[model samples]
Target: MAVSLWHKKVIFFGGKGGVGKTTCSASFGLLAAKRGLRTLVVSTDPAHSLGDIFATHIDEEGQLAPNLWGYEINPVKESERYTEQIKSQFQNVVSPVIMEEIQRQIEAAYSAPGSEEAAIFDKFIDMLERIETEFDLVVFDTAPTGHTLRLLSLPELLASWIEHLIAQREKANRLMSMAAVGSPELKEKTDKPDPVLATLKRREERFRRAREFIVDNQAASFIFVVNAEKLPIMETQKAMEILVKYQIPIGGVIVNRLLPTDQEGPFWTRRRELEKKYMAEIEEQFGSLILAKLPLLPDDIYGRQALDQIVQMLEEQIID
Candidate 1:
């Protein structure tokens, strides 16, 4: 079946590392722009390649083509931004002693386990919220499967963590009221709202909205790019299962870098035979979700002209 963008507004291209996700995503973004839709090609991978593919610059402004824009989010920078936002929001309300402690903790979290993902997820939520107003199509070239899966599951994990924090904060507030005001109920009927709790709840709500948008087919679709090989196939299969379990819709799988239809020599022949077996396995496993098959090109994919050829091939194979 041909890959179709008729229904989905946001498309994510994700797969095992080194599966040509960057190339395919760039091609799709160019194709969308050529079709007269305003498009944005975004790279969520730490190792950026969108700029390399376009042979130009991609930055926060995201202007890479006539009708297309590009952005590559650096997780470290994003995490810093997220930390600053938190500090700014809380510094005013908390005491000087507590403020200093919070500052220390936030600084210590620069290399925290999930800090990068949390920051990136926040940016992703912002994109999802503004995609329709900003562009007709937004194609995400995400990180490797394991990292991307962890990213997708962040909302669930973060929400639970936030809830636990909120519960603990409430208990502390009750204790504070009992000690100072002599009434546990005073915390509930406080004169002012708790800005700290308010901020956490707001973040939780944002995560929920992003999760809802991702699971909606009309809002977002995830496409897996895989080469017909052992490792890529196994990884893609696991990714598909995880995404499906989360109720995130899978648009289909793109079989990239297939062997040439006609090849000479024993090595080429043997490689093609191996590809055939794996390709059959992919078909048997994914069935109707197999969207397109792209042949391996002779040279490295670079610049607009080469991408244009890929777009043409995609248009031919993608479902109408």
Candidate 2:
């Protein structure tokens, strides 16, 4: 199928830490960009390595390259953005005291286990909605598999909550408007309801739209980057199950750092032998979905030259 059906078609790279997810994501974005598509590589991991892979400095916005752009989101900056939006939308309806309390609550919420992940997810969805018009493809270098699953699952969880909030707001609005022209008894009943309900309704609508953009497969897809190691492979399998359970679209998997088995001598022979063993397991487990295999390079994978090699490797068919 053509990849264009996905409005935003985000390819997320996620797996066990140290599995070369950032390098793979950068290579994919570079390849897409080289093919004449405007591509953006976004890094959501706290310890971002996209900048290192691209050999360029990136901040919250982005830095331009030949055909690709890169961005490393700062959690503090994202938290500030979230707070500003909440304050602007609720300033008029919420009392000053209530607004202060809400700000404190939001800060507290950000410290919770999944708070940062949720904030990053919201920023990603916001970027996809607003800036997708400027780029043909968006590649995300996500955190480890565990945190990435939490990020992907946020859309469905938030969708249900937003639907309930919207319903409650609709009910409140009808009652409040009726109170404006009805009898004194009715007016008294409506006046007691909190005015913040209207603002809440608007917020819920925005969240609903974001959720739709995420769950719509035509707009998003996830790619798991894994190695041949036992732990990494197990984590990838578990991650696949979670993504499928959430109804998120799964793209082909990228098996990174595969050893070339056609070399001579004992050192090369042992390396090749070990690789063959894991390669067989990988094929048996995910044969139908393997997209690319990247061989382990002797030097560090960074800069345009190295990235180009990685791209070429990704484009080649895996040899069984």
Candidate 3:
């Protein structure tokens, strides 16, 4: 079945490195904007090129066109911001001695595994919360296959981790409540709200919300941009399996950068012939999941006019 992307509130374009994910996603965002839907295209890759494609600087977020906005998330900056938010939550609640120790742990956590993903996911959740109110459609031009896969899978994995933390917090609160039955001072302390528990519950709820949005097929779509090559095709297939396993909605595949059929030279002819074989393999492997085929453009995809061409090509094949 042909995929209809215009209606999706959240659309993700992900694939192997150098497969033109940024260009495709930016073009789609531009298409949505042209259709009068307020659109925001975001780049979650650390090495961002979304601004390069649009010929505009978008370090955080900025208006690109009339109805389109662009954002390039910096992992380091987001991680730092996330860490500060975490540290602020413990202030005044914990004693100075304990606060000092907590600060040390937070510093250690800055370098821990998955820290960057967690921080970036927090920002991703922030963007999701603004959907509908701020923009009609939000397109994510994500990192390469492995990194993007981990980012998408974060909702499920982090939700489970948060649930465990909530459970532990609840258990501890119950123990405190039980022990406070005798002493008036302890009873007063237990009766008052627990800041730590409250923070944990809020984080848990945010993760839950993100998971719901990610798995909602009607609201979100994940598309892959692949080149007519062995590596990209294989990577896309693997990425699809992971998304399916997590129940994230798959929109379709876009085979980008196809060789032009009109080229006359022997080398060009051989390249197109090889491209045909891989294109056939893509059809065999993905079948109806193939959404669009984009040819190699004469010039680099930059600025509005070049991006407009991409919108034209996509509209030709993306009909439902």
Per-candidate TM equals 0.92, 0.85, 0.96
- 1-320 in candidate 2: lDDT tens per residue? 63542344577888999988998888878777767778888888888888877676766556557668888877777876876776687777677998899878877777676666666876877667654578777888999988778877776787688778867877867867675775887677566656566666665666667666656677777878888878888999999899888777777688888776666899988777777888888899888778888888878898989888988887565232
Order the candidate numbers by lDDT, best to worst. Answer: 3, 1, 2
Per-candidate Cα lDDT values, in order, are: 0.85, 0.77, 0.91
Best prediction by TM-score: 3
Q: List residue ranges in candidate 3 displaced over 4 A.
A: 1-3
Candidate scoring better on TM-score of 2 and 3: 3
Tens digit of per-residue lDDT, candidate 3, span 60-118: 99999999998888889999999999999998899999999999999999889878888
Q: What is residue 22's positional error in candidate 2, in angstroms?
A: 0.7
lDDT of 1 by residue, 1-320 (tens): 43356557889999999998999999888878878888888888989989989888766546877899998888888998999998999889989999999999888886778788888888887777777798888889999998888888887777788889989888877666666575557645564678887887888788888878777776688999999999999999899889989888898889999888777999999998999899899999987887788988988898888888788898888856
Poorly placed runs, candidate 2 (over 4 Å)? 1-8, 111-113, 166-195, 262-268, 318-320
User: TM-score rank, highest first?
Assistant: 3, 1, 2
- The C-alpha stretches of model 1 lying farther than 4 A from their native spots are 1-4, 178-190
